[model samples]
Target chain A: MTNKHNPAALNTGRRPLRGAGINLFYLPAILILIVFTVWPLLSGIQLSFTNWDGYSPTKAFVGLSNYLTMFKDHNFGTVLVNTLIYGVGSTAIQQVIGLGLALLLNSRIKGRNIMRAIIYLPALVSAVIMGTMYYFVFQYQQGALNTLMVSLGLPRVVWFDKPAVSVAIIVIINSLQYVGTSMIIYLAGLQGMDHSVIEAADLDGAHGWKKFRNITLPLLMPAFSTSVVLNLIGGLKLFDVIQVLTGGGPGYSTNSVSTYIGLTYFSNQNAGYASAMGVVLFVIIAIATTLLNKGLDRLGWES
Target chain B: MTSAIRHAEAASRSTDTTGKGNGKGGRRIGHALAYLFLGAMIVAQLLPFWLALSAASKPSTDMSSTLVPRLHDIAWDNFTTAITQGGILTAVGNSVIVTVCSTVLVCICGAAAAYPLARRKTRGNKLVSAGIMSLMMVPPLSILVPLYTLMVNTGGVNTRWGIVLVTVAGNLPLAIFLYTAFIKAVPESIDEAGMIDGASRFMIFIRLILPLLKPVTATVVIMTSVGVWNEYALSNYLISDPGKQLIAPRVASFFAMQSSNLGVGAASALIAALPIVIVYLFLQRYFIAGIAAGAEK
Candidate 1:
């Protein structure tokens, strides 16, 4: 396996025909990334330092003023808290529901295929569309839930009026819509599990809850990590759903950092401040992702 | 990322279930509980769509509860209004154009970039690979200020190519990662054999390596199209023109305008969702695979 002439080693290493000139193949992608991603990221940092209105030609250096303003902005604190809620809150719901569904459906049950398909279907639709459809349930007037409430002789409550309720609805919608993602990942984890290990546990009198707790759950750690990271990032970047459902409204009460950036830059014309929010968002996500990966690596027993 | 691809591949092949016996009474209770949970979830998952369908099929004058089905006299007019007044059809067209262009660009650029990193494996190429992969973590909205500024200054905003370029960049990292992993698994002998036949490196990549990338390319195409089609954060701002807006933003704006006409709003939302739903029904496996690959990012 260590020999250079072995095809496996050769395939992973620098091969004979794969010369330096071939590096040109990646130049276009690298260029696109540089111009579109890397450059904007750098410029975002630069823009954060100046008080430049988004469209204006002239600007003055603001030093740390934009970043400093965040400390004093009450709405900024709420938005930050909402962002964490969306991220951690959605991740929690998705994992619980997703794994529960995966555990139930990973069997010889009738309609399991259709169940899986239907469960995962929402993940395929645009979140904006999902959010709009979900509005039928939460609409103040003639909403489905309200109709149900009225039929039961209860009061029809306005769902999005309160900040807490609006935030919870956002989290629930996001989690339900993409919980299928985590479900499928866990299903795959279940499918890829070494059956022999499970059978051995069975032979050793491990069954049902005991088996799942001691064996199945631990075995699913890789999938758990993958799903958690994906869900967390997706939830943190919660934009489309919030945009459609609440529009981060009721006085910016439900704005994730992502949506708040939009509100500040577009509506408020605070591009410099928005750029600082963007920088904060980038740092938060980068740090969160790295920490999760590291922490999950330590937690995963199979590796 | 490779783990996702591997897991999906494994999932597609294995249908084995952990249905080993437990204590009889406990097992029966567990099964009952599972069934109860599954039924509840099914209803919960489908309820919104059901409500939307009911609303979409009714006229604004039909103030019936959304929980009830519009069994008879279903108003097709709502969907028609969605197309006519909501501009959903045009938005769909714009989404298609952007999605197709971005997906194709991502496939080409991703596969091409992957060849060197997977085959050549120079220190610089490895570094480049790591850097590109890292870009996947940068949420698009985080770069919104500068990216939008750059697009405006470059006259890139509101143009089809503008959205296309931005989406291609956004999607390229995952595409490249998927491609690189796939290409690495391809034996080096294939490229060596091409070289022995006097093919240039580019020729070998195109003539030999490219053909072998079909499976992974399917994954990339499926993932990129879904992503680019559903994209909102950047697309909403970069292409604010009504005619140029993608489906997500277009639907959001339409929903906003139709607040007084909830039926029309529901119709527009359903219309926007229809294409992806149809595609998902037909290609469920690929969508699952796309999730697996996308989950890695």
Candidate 2:
């Protein structure tokens, strides 16, 4: 089996038709992608400029009116602000906690694997389930938190009743569920580090926070970017937990782009407006991810 | 100097130049503190799930009065009511079907699309790869409005097959990206060796490549299936039928029931998540690998 052709044999000008089987391998996925993923993306842009209610067979073009209304809608304003806060806030919490866990776990520790798995447990449940479980935890009256607080002679507070607090709560819940992912990524990065360098640092008489600041974090930038992008995008698109927990309630203050888009499209009976909002949401995510990744790349290069 | 060495140097500078015994004792204390902090956090994290589980076991009426109803207050009726009254059985069945179908198809299609793109250096394939790459970056939400309308128009709404196709389509990019990276590591000699045996490319893919893809497949399968299983927005918006919908939305209806009885609702929610959680427990190694691999791209 090995004698006939070396790996060097395949790519030498005979690569154009590596095996006429290329189409067979590519077509099924490409076809499905075109129909489901590509088509809607193309059409969605066109739909956003119109006033097409979902039920209407014909979409009368409104030429940026939908976009205009989306920008001006006070509810949209709050949703946009909430989306930013959620994305930034959740990413911040997850990063700090995740990196701390990674650094701690990387050191010699007992029950490390168990701790990692336990932290990741919350992530296994769906957002709706987490939100529901937490609904019990945050109930103003008989809620777990309130019960504990009262038992400790502290004041009991309603968690989701206030719009701003609900927004903050949404970010906290997202961070709690997802921080494990960042930890795992960072741990992988830590494990991949060249240990010889650490030994050299030890020989150089350096240790502790100085070692981490000068060495570990920079090398882990790729993992850091991955974690940030994932958390940021996830935070931006947050829906299920916020939906279940607050339903964008105390008014639309807790709504991120996802839940707002759902509400607009389904209940508001305004597909065009929803499409416009979706497009805007898409733009925000695209721009933020690009900027964040680029900024990180530059930072790594500059350092 | 490499940041690695530089940081190492900085670390060495900060350490005490004192005797080894004192350093060892100090390190022990630091290690103990790290353990203590992590232990407390782990407990804090697990407490909510534990509380929910305990609540699920309790009688509905007792849940309201007790912060975490004791196991002694257990009511087997929570499961009975959840299964019987909550329509949990049907929702679970539907979720299983959708998640399985989508995951399998995504794996297959992702493999198919990834192989050529990853291997071929030709201009045409490069262009195609670039297209898929960019498309991968686009948010599925941006296309939600049109996707919903198309699904509706094509009679895809509320259908098992419809959601399956949608889920597969939505998740393909990540799968393809992962598979491509995985495959690139497979030396072309394996394929060339197979080709010398008169095995065609399709045969090589099936007979050779498929088996080798086991690790990435686990990653893809776990990630995609869990994603589809837990999905709420797509299933809810696309499948309006209460009975036909997946567990997320179906479980969502339990919120109303939860207002009255936390036990039954918690029981139902846990039941809905039980399958994925069980899968994660068994395949935790692959689950962690998958998260890392998926993110590395």
Candidate 3:
């Protein structure tokens, strides 16, 4: 055991036993993850099947009744559709705005850094805070947008009082805050672009649209996928802004799956119901994102 | 090989043509238009926050008359009112403790576990890395239903520590992912060099690795801390006590309770956001880099 002078012994000294001993470094993390992450997740599945109201001592196994009840519940269709719209609509529109801005901002514009900072500044504040501020701006009569609209001799419309309008406002507000995320990713991607591809396209008489479609967009698949995935996921799990902005109100019309679960658990005290809904949402997100990734995989043809 | 050579020649020729052709008449106009577009976007981004700040300082009676702030309308009472009315100070304390403690735990554990994964290339290591990465993909709140129930059953509800545990768990995957990426960049020779001197693996990690990890550690710390500070969902659900809640939930309730009074709500929003805004303004460059690293991963 005392191979004190041999360098090669250092490698073998740690081969079988001591080498595996180093895995103890992983124990704290693995432990914390197991307790906090793994257990909760497994129990999440188990708890969903139990008729526990988050507090009631009497817990009984209920099988798939919670899922079946949710399937029959009238709000399920509304909430599920609302979630898909939020996730898809926001992700789709943000890509265009973010990519467009990133492209323009990537140019040698005056105060580009300042502009980039401004673009990204909204991302710094909590969505709660942003929603709070916009609550002022989107107020029915005295709000900033309505005031500006009236000044321009346009009709002053109610923004939050209506269900459809509220959903649209939520989408717009969220898209504005996160567009910079897509922008930053795209800007980074554009910055790291292999210029030879664009140059090669130029030599083939490929102009702006052609070169962008063929070369730039194809090369940006990584960043595009990153932006799309993050935004879609963020949209799906949205709770904070929906909480502050509309409170998923006007009769649950604006309720995302997350907000619905929060409401069911906290307000309604239907914990088992909430857990079941959570599982369903988890499965939905998994399936949706997997399909999305698969769809994007094909468009990433050059890769 | 021949086609690649031919393409390289064509690329150089096109680079000259594109460079010279694009530098002329069309560039100036496009630049001006782009500036105009960017200016409008900046205003859109800033207007609400600006109005909120302006409204915060204005007397409530005069808040709706104009969107601009006036010196005569400056109301120092709003800040005082915000503190007293909303339990703002208590919420801020809760946020600081929760954010700071969780970030520290996450950084330590994430950085620690990342080392062996980075150094030892094994099938198990790869599986762990993939597990951690996929964990990042799952909306952490997808598991919140169970997590919240577990906390409640364990007498963890309404506690700062409960929120902290949730925060650490949520932040770990990203922290580990980022740290492992950064730790991989550190030469394995450093560990080898330390090992030759009879330093235990743990000692090498402590004496050699931790210091080398300061930059990424800073990145992880700032990201996780800021995130935990803004976290509303966990704090909203897990911590039921009003006094123990973080500023995010408090700010939300403050504005909601005061929704009828835009002036006060604006003021409370500003007060809630002030600390984070100041921090962002200071460490903005690092913040950008940290977020970028976070995104690319």
Q: Fnat of the models, one by one?
A: 0.72, 0.63, 0.49
Backbone-clash count (model 3): 0
TM-score, B chain alone, candidates in order: 0.90, 0.86, 0.90
The candidate with the higher lDDT, 1 or 3, is 1
Give one digit per residue, the lDDT tens place, for model 3 in A75-190: 87788888888888899988998998999888887788878887888887889998898776777656788789988999987787788888888888899988888899899899
- Considering only chain B, report the TM-score of model 1: 0.90
Per-residue C-alpha lDDT of model 2 across residues B85-178, encoded as one tens digit per residue = 8888899999998988999899988987888877765688777777776666566566778998888789999999999998888888889888
Docking class of 1: acceptable
- Considering only N, C-alpha and C atoms within 3 Å, which residue pairs clash in candidate 1? none
Estimate, for each residue in A94-210, the C-alpha lDDT of model 2 and write its tens digit: 999899899988777778887888888777678888888777778776678888898899998978778877887788888989889999999999988888777777777655765
**How close to the true structure is residue B72 of candidate 2, measured as C-alpha lDDT?**
60
Q: Compared with the true structure, what per-residue lDDT tens digits does model 1 show for residues B115-206?
A: 98998877888899999988999998999999998898899999999999999999999999999998989998888877555567878988
Which one is best on TM-score? 1
Poorest 10 consecutive residues by lDDT, candidate 1 chain B: B6-15
Model 3 CAPRI quality = acceptable
